[model samples]
Target: MLKGFLHHYYAFGLKVTSDWALPCSQRVQPTFATLEFRKQQAAFFAARVPRALRSQDPARIHYHDLEDGSRYLKWRGVFEFLISPDSQVVFGHSLDGAPAAAFRSYMLGHVFSYALLGFGIETFHATCVVVDGEAIAFLGDSARGKSTLAAAFLADGAELVTDDFLVLGREGKGYIAYPGLPRIKLYRSMSKHLLPARKGQRFTPGRVPKYLYPMEPVTKPQPLRAFYSLVSPDAIKSQTEVRIEALAPRQAYLEITENTFNVRVQTRERLESQFRWATEVVTRVPVKRLSYPRTLKVLPEVIAAVRADLQASR
Candidate 1:
């Protein structure tokens, strides 16, 4: 026995060799058909690499295109990952004594996002909920309450599609939102208030205080019903009422660009494709700005207003 574990991350079945436990909320079998794991021997790079995707000075996180055409990534303190040239498989290596929780966290977030991008699927820094069988996504930067609002929707009986990384693709003439891994990362304060039924576990023991709330995931891709780019708090000055404003096509396109999770890795071809997809998406679907006071007490009102808006759109 290789001593491996099997799980489903988003829609893909993952066979992991790392010493990590799969989420308790989602059902993962003990076996898998397709496997991705770590390399036994580490690879070394030359001092003067000819080609590189992105590299920081301190070299904490870097992407390299090796002579063999594989993609290499290093998350210094966490893990290192390599994506096959064909983008069919991923190889990962967790730092010595690295907790599996931390490995799972970065895998589902940045590493997986990069791999999906390599495979030509676009991901957004957004969270989404299923509203009446379709996906209603909330897009924004960090700390803009994307996850909290998703938890509110989940509390209101909507199934969660994703919490942080939202994968999307085009279906027919409109866009469809793919289901992500069945987990939600919530801060302790928000978890206490929003996720009462589900038990919360720390995302990673020592790194972050956020708790991961695993839930029943919506596995199939759903048609994107609407997209809301949450405005930053400073953008709304003393706003008491929840405001929903339809965004113009240009504005929607810009917001989409900003919220793209792997915008930096986009090549020229990818850039053109994203632009075309975004343009078509904005025309076929509504994109709006959802703004309100960042107060937990008013969350119910905000959720009610969002539902009303969605209903009216339909």
Candidate 2:
């Protein structure tokens, strides 16, 4: 008999069969949905076609549509996930190491975001923090300091709402945001600079050099207060201090759509639904461009600038 590990994350109960325990999630009854792991199969998927959604990392992903109407994803050396149209059961296996090797694989990409996307859920590559009883999100490209800025806010007494994968849903007049796993991934340099005393376990020790620090996460969902696109003008040789500029609804809508996770694989119906949701979200929530000098020394000033802006808005 497979005894499932009960976990509560993103407002759902999960009975995960893998050794994937997020320190921040609450232990609950094993009555919820289950994600089982099995041995990896080499002949599980069909041939790789000449054309598919290709990222810079060629082996990052290879998606296929089988003759039997099944969808398969070969995610590099991580794992292959097979999901049915109903989006209920997900079967996964690690490409290397033991069955538990899929633990980090699922944590990195497979489990929540991909599974939710299968169900047509709208998720973004962003981190969120609760301020004044409302949620504020920071979205940006990789290594653009989304997590760095989030760490700054976490140091300054703001509670973390989510990290990396932000889940959004329609709730009455506005949208409600759910918290991801209660953790933040930070680089060694930033962790030492911002949180010198805080010890974090290494996430991708030699390869990524990032550490995962467990956070005291907010339990309930909160209405989104604002969303910001964190950018650094210093990359283009422009000297600018911390600044927050309100983005026009049109621009904000575009940014929101672009930052959506796994957008390439979305069906036409899912894309249309996301368009409607993003349109409504931008109209009500304040979307701004948060530009600041790209330097570690000014992070405190950047955090203060954001705090002042949020206060003045209220």
**Candidate 1 lDDT tens digits, 204-311:** 455558888878877667888999999998988788899999998899999888898875675688798788767777898788999999999888998899889989
Which ten contiguous residues of candidate 2 have the minimum total lDDT? Answer: 47-56
Error of 2 at 184 (Å): 0.6
lDDT of 2 by residue, 211-248 (tens): 87777787766788789887745463576567788999
Every candidate's CA RMSD = 4.2, 4.5
User: How close is every model to the real structure, measured as TM-score?
Assistant: 0.84, 0.82
The clash number for model 2 is: 0
Residue runs of model 2 more than 4 Å from their true location after superposition = 1-24, 27-58, 66-70, 98-111, 205-208, 232-236
Question: For model 1, what is the error of residue 307's alpha carbon versus the real structure, in angstroms, after optimal superposition?
Answer: 1.1
Candidate that scores best on lDDT: 1
Each model's lDDT comes to: 0.74, 0.68
